[model samples]
Target: MSTSVPYFHHFQKDTTGIERPVRFTFPFCYDPHELSILAAEQVQTYLAGQNDFIHNFGLMDGQEGLVIGKMFGVLVVQDQEGNLGFLAAVSGKMAGSNKHRYFVPPIFDMLDPEGFFLREEEHINQINRNIELLQKSAELKELRENLVQCKKHEEQILSERRKLHKKNKAERKERRIAQQPCLPEQAYQELLEDLIKQSYRDQHHYDVQKEKSTQQIKLAEDALNHILDQIEELKSERRTRSSNLQNQLFDQYHFLNARKESKSVLAIFTESKNIQPPAGAGECAAPKLLQYAFNHQLTPICMAEFWWGSSPNLEVRKHKNYYPACRGKCEPILGHMLLGLNVDDNPMLENPAADKELEIIFEDEAIIVVNKPAEFLSVPGINVKDSVQTRIQNRYPEMDSPLIIHRLDMSTSGILVLAKSKDAHQFIQDQFIKHTVKKRYTALLDGLISGKEGLIDLPLRVDLDDRPRQVVCYEHGKPAQTKYKVVSIEGKNTRIHFFPLTGRTHQLRVHSAHQKGLNCAIIGDDLYGKRADRLHLHAAFIQFVHPLTKSLVQFEVKDPF
Candidate 1:
């Protein structure tokens, strides 16, 4: 029997009424099934008490080394004999090793001492050390300094000589102009010849001095170039070796599907996007769990992944929160591994606003204000073309430029304004750009808060790994600000009013859920928090200057929730 068979853990508690899912959990987006959740709980218990490995999860104050939280996953499986159990795996390496007793082993163990990866990596490190020593050597440093000084000295000498020559020429020209009328013809010719001779002598001197300085600079530059040439050659060699090693590593990562078909990381990515595989391609928890189950002949029922410790500085990750697989690295790999197995339908493909209607609040010759319902799209999407813009164009065929001035999130219900003419669009858009337009939103937070009102100044950017989801990134994010006032407290929920100062994608949602902001997710925010029937956020009021009237116009809508 394979050594990995022991890693399969049987459920310790009674699972009497737990039902099995008919389809496998969609790795991209899903609610954790009961079996998967139970397996994850058992894995968490083991993590809390385990003493076999050492990793800093930032849970304690005195832990050494860099504190890095990790994502863990569990797969509910049934063996050939119908014995129910689960397999555990973590993303990337844990405790500087991939060989843990309770977790499934990595598909390719590059850290093994006997592996080719380490051997090539050591060779690369030696090249780097040689380059560093050369760069720091006193001889190379002196050569560089000498070259700089030589060039400066050459320029100074040439400039001084040119200035002297200019002064002498000017003096000679004045002497000729003044003395030409005073002297006789023979005397004047003699004076001009003498001046010509003086000019030739000065020119010869400047040329000689310039040659000497040029030679000195050339000698210094030659010496410096010799060392730089060597360094460049070493760098070129290192780059070639690194590229070859990365290609070899990618070739070694072969993934298996449920149908027993195999494909390497390089080949799979090439077939999908015609690009190289991203870093940490097949090392995530989902791929490792699926690979192990397929190799062991275990039937995969469902799976779930969750964060286990402190959140990363660049991304928002709460402890013990379930998350979907990342699209950048794991999506392509999982798309291949989940083959031959029935999976749940992707909920994102379905149009949520198919049955919703757009209610017009007010209309005029230049603009129209409408109450957009929850789950309705403000604009057309890739799969769904039915949106507010499309509907407006259909209703008013003669309306030129039916421009959508601003947008609300597809899940958010609110008052949306549209322009019927180009002039009106530009006028209203200028107000938004200048931050003169005022907007207020009503939302129901999932938790209660003590503060009546406060300002949130967290910056936001899209999580590149997961599309449509936003993260609080201070380094490369746009400024997003919001002011909120608590309206009422109902049971465990709190109704609040949000006044946005700047507009950014998912600005309000991330601010509500991020720890640095309110630390309380808005109700029914599926991306950042738990999903409910619909998002509780609604745009209640909007105020802006009218185009034709040039007067301040405002509109309001009552929140349904």
Candidate 2:
């Protein structure tokens, strides 16, 4: 640590365009990596003292609980020249300074009502409100709707008049042909003429009404179009004004790089491929830490982000555990900000699965079932190349087309089915698609469950921003169903049996974790619950009618935990 830094000055220009010294404590400068190690060690020591969890994770019965909330830490660094800083950020959220006295304040302090940025934001919001109002204006809507209704009614009236005329004409012709000749020729001609005149009168009456309706409708439509044009013109003007203001606001958001040079929002993003600034550029914890350091001329060393709140129901997070920045949110922005800094790798993907032998439970010429160990992927995935299929291919060098029939979560352990022949694969796959294949699993729930047994039907879809994780959404998700029965209950835990009626990604884990379903995640589920040595859920049993033999087959494996 440098003893030289007693104090440092940092400033930001307000909405009034006045640059003034910012009032916040500057973190002490140190080796970033060294600082990270020290901070993590300190956090670890503190966690060890807490009874909320056990330190020995990844061991069955050795580690027994979870701690809620994630924490973020930073190690301020200083270079020899100390030109200082760049703007950057990490994934997750910030622990606000107001809530935690030891924490740093937000970059813009948006909560400050008197702040210039907040005022500007309010102006932008007002513009948005006006645009919304224009879109839903009742007066404009009524005018357009009335025009549409009038036009439709006129068309219907015209068609009805024409149909009646056709019917009358046919009737008149029928009378002329069926009845013997009328009284006198002149009288008959006169009667026919009269009949034609009556038809014409009906047509004329409706046509007059249609013309009046059309004229009124046209007037209303013209008014509506004018109003629409005015709204569009206003919207265009607002967009131009908004764009200029936003561009100015973005320019004010200058970030520091490792070399301690400031770059405006426009300069940084526009330099590379003309991408627009991310919606929330300088708001994240990493950026705030970096910005604070650079403004105060502190060296950036090493930093880390950890989740501090209750884990989101769908995404995996452990309180106090260190993690990497989310790739989707932070990568591009940080790529521009950390132009020269030597950033560390993401700690999450560092642990790749090693070669584990496939546990073959059953094998036939048509089909084979194996018990896949947890941490091994059912099939190859991005960043996960060595999977069950690759291992199977190695073992069965002579195997024919598409041996894999079904899959399991990489973190889940259980029975995995594989086909030896293409015909067998199709037959078994057909059974799954038809819901004829039945599978049962055993899981250890994190907490006591309310129900002894029940069916869970949840619609699940992938969370695109966060890969590999699935979310339960009724609107866009696919149908997933599971039947669970309580097997036993232990201290702070419940044992249960799950019979899945439909197969979906993370179906069992999501079914257990989602609030609507079991409401208790499987114990040791890192993505859904707390991180542990292994995910406690396992595929224990499976049954289906044989494709080749035309006989039913059921296979069950004993639960390891």
Candidate 3:
């Protein structure tokens, strides 16, 4: 607490035995370095005993306000004098303030009373209030109701007129048909002329009535539009002001890289994706940490981010568990900030299945079944193009249809069915689409499950902030259901069978890891759980009607682990 630097904290315990990491941590996906973990442990210890703050993390009872957990980060940094220490940061504001005595300050503080953000925000809020007041006014309400009634009245009057006109025309037609056979030629002509005159009179009356009704409706609509126009003007002004303020704020968030080069948030995003920076782009823990390190002349060694307190309702977050920096917000920011520093390479760029081979389990003229190895891609990916699909297409040059009928996660090893012809593909793909294809996956869970068998009905969607990682989102997610039966309990791991009823992306993995489902992560699930040698998930059995013979066919492959 008494260091020369306000946010820097030296290690309380002896650290002579631990070696410093040679390169900085990769923010997106990483295992926390030992030093980074130690720094985080110390920060957590301070959080436990602190009395200066009142944020409700939902860790203890009787805490006031919303139960929002936070992502805390630790950056292992060395000072200008080569002193080993670390800096801590929270993702956003803590206890409604950006300045904490023990943590690094935000890249830009929008909460400052003298700042333009607050002043402009207040103006926008006033616009909102004005719009709300006008919307709720009795005059506006009455106008809206009057317009509705006017429309109804117009419809009723027009309907009656049309009905009467139709009836009169039908009667005239009947009279003409009956009179034509009985009356003399001159008499029939006179009768026809009289009927025509009657029809013209009816038509004239209907047109006059229609014009009157339309004018009434138009009058009501104009009255409503007068008030609505004012409201719309205010809304348009508010939108323009809000957009300008956001752009100004983005400009104010200047970030520094290891090379001492500076760039605003707006420039960084513009250069990267040609889009405006997302809200809270520069406010993440990683950006704040790197910004402060550069400003204070601290050499960043490694970094780690962890969640503390209760998990979010839609996303899975465990207390005190390490998480990668979000890709959506921090990827571009860090891409600029980490320049000139020797950061670890992104692991996603490396193909895990580059050296692994795809084993053919069964094959025929119409279809091919392969025992796909773990860490293999079902199809070509962004960085790596070598996959089962590519290999199969190369092997069978004469096959004209898309080879993969079904897919497995790159980390998942299992039986995959491929089609040789377009007809075969459609026939089998239809079965999967209709949920008629039965599949069973074998997975080793990191934790023991108590129940024997149960259904997990958690919905899933891709975490927009982190690609490829799915979160449980009821509002926006596709239905994902999995039935699991525990096969055996081995010391600390539970082997289970998963029968997925829906084929949503990462369905089985998210269902197993989510707290609402099994509350256990699949072993070696790097995206949802801790990293290990390989993901312990396999498509062990599959059953479907053969596309060629229209006969029930099944395939089974034993899992390696």
Candidate 4:
């Protein structure tokens, strides 16, 4: 064959009688596995000094113009006329420009088909093909039909065989019974023999079953007796405990009522008797004596010791109070003589020896409110010591065990409520649990808040890693919300009026401190804020319907913040 002509590549198209320089480079289509280093080097050398441009030359749609690799080449003037000429010129110019600007040949790169990731893809493709083949296989289809047919046939054969076998066996048994010898005496003898044998067998079976049933009945009776005995024991124990508790309650009630009755004695000692006293003794009047008794919990020994001096020759004799006394009783005349007022009345009698006095802020038949001090906790905590609960316990010694419904923080100074009766307690507690109680608080945060009003909708939940610390977790947190409006902005502090929508511990404190971009907490909130002497938050108002009267009850405290 003649030597192949070196073709001229034209750079212009869509014009008549035009000639321009155009570049021509080798075009290649290769699978990743077909790539060779020599081919890569040749492409690189040829494309040196050329700008980069991508051209798709593939059978697949939407995949041709992707960057495959880069190469550089220069175009020499050529004579041609066609769209291909124009396209070649434009691509060559682009490639040259990239090469000149970037100082590197334009390389066309493509994903290698034989790469490990692509091989996995290929493996998946092959498996899919195998699955498709299996789905479309004629043998599988024919085998499935054959299996159905064979199963149906086997069922039919088995059914027919069973019927035939059953009929045959029944007929054979009947024929054997009919073929037996027939003689009256022999028949009777055989009948008698069978009857005797059946009777004996029946008796033996009955005896065994009867013995077993008798044992079972005995066991059942014993179990029932044991159950009855246990029930009796339980009843006896319950009766004993009930009697003991009732007796204790009775004794305690009598003792308290007796003290109340003794308070009348104090009144009698002061007003009715008109007993004149020495200097300053009028202060310890009968009411004062009764008040002291109420305060000191007037036990028999305490009452005797205070009234009568410790003299052995007082000639004391036992009377009404003797049985209550363990050993000796005070003489009535001696008690009366000692009970008369004096100017130098004992101050100890005026004020009881008790450590603290109960300050009852509000008291009614149903409810009681107490203004808790700063350091004391509102309710019993831990061992329930140094709390409002303990104070109430000592104050209301006449009441059965008192129940505390709600709590405030230890440092929080506000009106605390208690229910006197169980019914009232349940009513108030239900209102709280149902969120019918409206509570508001005033707090001072450490920074000047810009917003006049805003709502914090951030959710909160207990932090698992840190006890007592609440965390913000949008995806997995309980919904906690607080509505806050700025009341006043003073210096570096902002007073916020807060209405909590949810009752989570430390919700407002944590939200203010942990909010994004506005990380200012209430002053003196140690857990969520910088150290301060005391928290600047205060419970300013509490409102709820009264449990007993069903009247609207509202309480307010001056905001400390």
Candidate 5:
């Protein structure tokens, strides 16, 4: 009856160069030094008992926990390459060797539980206080709601009061008409009764509001006391464990709770007008739009999940990996947030006109298409030196600048399109997003090809270390398809036409280089082709619907090379 969770998987290339998967489990925690020896022993025992293939043991990062009032990490075998060199700091010491001849203490030596308990005590106390305040505020809010209800009824009461006043005035006005005053005593008695009733109703409504307020106050007080008691218990326990901890109190780690809100106005130059973040302007590492919204107390509507990837701000959520020892958890303490503006803000881009020349192939009121050469950027970077977009802007200063609806690889030279207005940009962008638009490319390959036309369907995912290079991953990769037709076959080069149905990072290069027994690779693809002048793929044809006209439009260009 073994109870352990498998957190990671193992993979290796088979004889045919195809990836094969194997699963393994690791202990929740492991001692760094003894993990290797223990894992080796476990492997030997497993072989002796069951004679299973048991290729290797799996190990993972160390975790911290408390058992029977003592703090210790679990020691377990790591899967594949369970060498001591791979052992990292699990619970009680800094990762790597701490053999430096210095007065400083090892990192993990300071990670005792005594200090953590104290910090937990403080946090509990603070939370309890916050809960009490929240309760009081809620009570006040309820009272305000009641007051509001009373105010709404005031309109009806005021109307009735006016009607009564008018009736009394009319009766007085008709006194001359009813000169026969036999019922004067009766009329006076009626008036007195009405006055008494009005006074009673006003006093009753006031008393109801007061009573509700008093009841709410009592409820809030009770909740406050309960929260206070819980905090007190936590504090007392922490105090008792203070001796076992390296420090009396654990260092407080602050996690700011971003408040959610919306804004009506967004300044082009400044942030949202009304929202202000917990700290002004620069606390988070997000785009300007995100930062501005954060500053204004507007929470991010978007959630990002990060790993070892190129995309920014993608990180693990709080609830996903609660264990303190997880790598995802450690990365946060080491790397803070980085901030920039939207896609248009290429802070690193310089002026494009300073370097290579840009050739505008087509321009109109709706769209501006260019034959962008290689080494020229698709959009402006920080300083706007020589990006395709900047060049177009610099050349046509008078034309309302075109917005980049999409992007192309910087090293890739091909036909590029830009929208003149937001409507056009949005419309074209939607087509690209839906994969409704058609894109054709011309590429010269590394080897000859005899196929007239063929389709390749291989899933693609980021490589482990070098994410820019897409790899074949049948398990986790996204579906990608490309159709190719051989146009001509030279001695060692094959010119081909490619049609990609899906848009991934490097779908064409990865698919063409698949181990399907052909040496053909796109020219100039150093990552995939290894040694090439350039990736010979060119964007030759683009077709989509016109944003304003709703009419089908298409553009094509002959390969310059």
Candidate 6:
């Protein structure tokens, strides 16, 4: 196997060897030969000093990067001539170094002002501005005002007619009431005659008002329809123009992959079974590394990618964590690119021991408490069903009343509480809701914190694009609170105690990993920190009022680390 250390050198290629057509593809700016030669030294330094496999992160406090990132690198190999060079990449978006001396250039940079996409986009913007200006057209404004005036005039006439009708009704009621029980023949006759006259007058006035309203409304309707027709015509014209421009822009966008083959937007869709290009294609790290290699005729070796900076709100990402090329996007395109090249299997996607035995710590008729091992799932997942709930169902087939009430991260190992009866389950869960259940977690933070203890109040939301990864977002996030205290210092690593107030998903993990928060990812965190055998976070202690006995009961477990 080649050494983990990076080796970079120039591998000259003929510029006149292949001619590319005039097409708009992702812009890549880097001399493959020059980059390989330059980037290898940094790779070597990183592998030799940091990625020794013996030296892991989160062990010492006050270190540079506790949540160290994974690196996806390409070591372009050409064994025929005994020439060597390497290219480097980190997973996700790194804080700095996208414009590093050694990195490959982007496929398409829409940020350029001269770019056709940007120019076309400006056209679309101008079209929108025109549409807005059209809404304020004098012709349309006059039509609207005429309609409003017509409606107001009609309403005023109807209101006056209603008032006349009301007066006529009141007069009729008064005349009838006066002749109620014992009315003289002459008096009754007079009231009847008077009421008939008033009714006829009211009816005549109402009919005149209605006729006037109908005529005015018809005229207004005809006028309004003409204005509406004009508006719709204008909209249709704008839409057509916009659609034509969009098509032109799409036609102009051509993308190049690792094969150094350029294809238009339509061609790419026609080639693939998918209706559209997968999201965030061409821009990912894997494609960048591969494209750089293919352009220089460099052979593919092995590649690794790591993430840096804050995790996106949708996906599960941690700084310095290794992640495979996204399957949805990179797979189909890379499948075409890496057709005959002997590529290594991605280890990041492999799951060796998904199912493991559970160790029960304490059990009773009301509840059962167990010591959960790391790498074991708490509940059944969409893809994997080897969870604590599944295991319990398998172990206790005859007993099924209450179920798993709480959850722990699959990478976390510690005490877990389960209820045997529905009553106990509701009571226990209620305590959690009321914040009466006190829970304490122990974690080995990657960095040494300055303050011994403090509170972290940050809102968290799951990254929809990446499951199980949470991000700190104030606008759309759940309120999360965590109180932490430094337990002990092991070399540079600090053992800490966590008291979480809200049970948000990945609450503690996000809080610790976020820069504004603790900025210390738990040890062995694949998503947020350096990967190890297991995440160094455990639920150590839990105390709550007993449902059956009405007494406070507490449970504690020893730290595995």
Best by TM-score: 1
Structural similarity to truth (TM-score) of each candidate: 0.93, 0.70, 0.90, 0.37, 0.38, 0.70
| Superior by TM-score: candidate 5 or candidate 6 | 6
**Backbone atom clashes (below 3 Å) for every candidate:** 0, 20, 0, 26, 35, 26
Candidate 1 Cα misplacement greater than 4 A, ranges = 1-4, 126-144, 182-187
* lDDT by residue for model 3 (148-226), tens: 9999999999999999999999999999999999999999999999999999999999999999998999999999999
Q: Where does model 5 exceed 4 Å of error?
A: 1-354, 381-385, 396-402, 516-519
lDDT of 1 at 393: 92
Error of 1 at 321 (Å): 1.2
Q: Per-residue CA lDDT of candidate 6, range 96-139, in tens?
A: 32434445655555445677766766776775676576577887
Per-residue error for 222 in candidate 2, Å, reads 2.5
**Model 4 per-residue lDDT tens digits across residues 1-561:** 111112222222233343221211111101111112222222334343343444332223576343222112122211222122100111122322322322222121112354343454455455455555655667556555555565555556555655655665566556446645554667756765765565566556555655655565555555444544554555565566544543332222111122243322233334544542211121121222223223333311111101111111111111111111111111111133233222123221231213433345678888887765544566555543557776777677776535577776665556677888788888988888888888888888888877888788777777542345567777777888888888898899998888877777677777677644135778866455543666777777788889878998988878754
lDDT (C-alpha, whole model) for all candidates? 0.91, 0.68, 0.91, 0.47, 0.48, 0.67
lDDT of 1 by residue, 1-561 (tens): 222476899887877689899999998879899999999999999999999999999998999989899999999998888888899999999889989999999999989999999999999999898889889989899999999999999999999999999999999999999999999999999999999999999999999999999999999989998988888888898999999999989988999999999999988888887988988899999999999999999999999999998877766677788888998888888999999999999877888777888899999999999999988889998988888999999999888894799999998999999999999999999999999999999999989887899999988888876777888877888899999999999999999999999999988888887878788889888777776888899999999999999999999999999
Query: Distance from true position, residue 272, model 3, in Å?
Result: 1.6
TM-score of 4: 0.37
Those runs of model 6 whose alpha carbons end farther than 4 Å from true positions after fitting are: 1-82, 88-105, 108-116, 131-161, 176-279, 306-357
lDDT of 6 at 522: 89
Model 4 CA lDDT for position 397: 72
Pick out the ten consecutive residues of candidate 2 with the lowest summed lDDT.
Answer: 20-29
- Model 5, 305-366: lDDT tens digits are 11110111111111111111222222222112112211122222434336567777777788
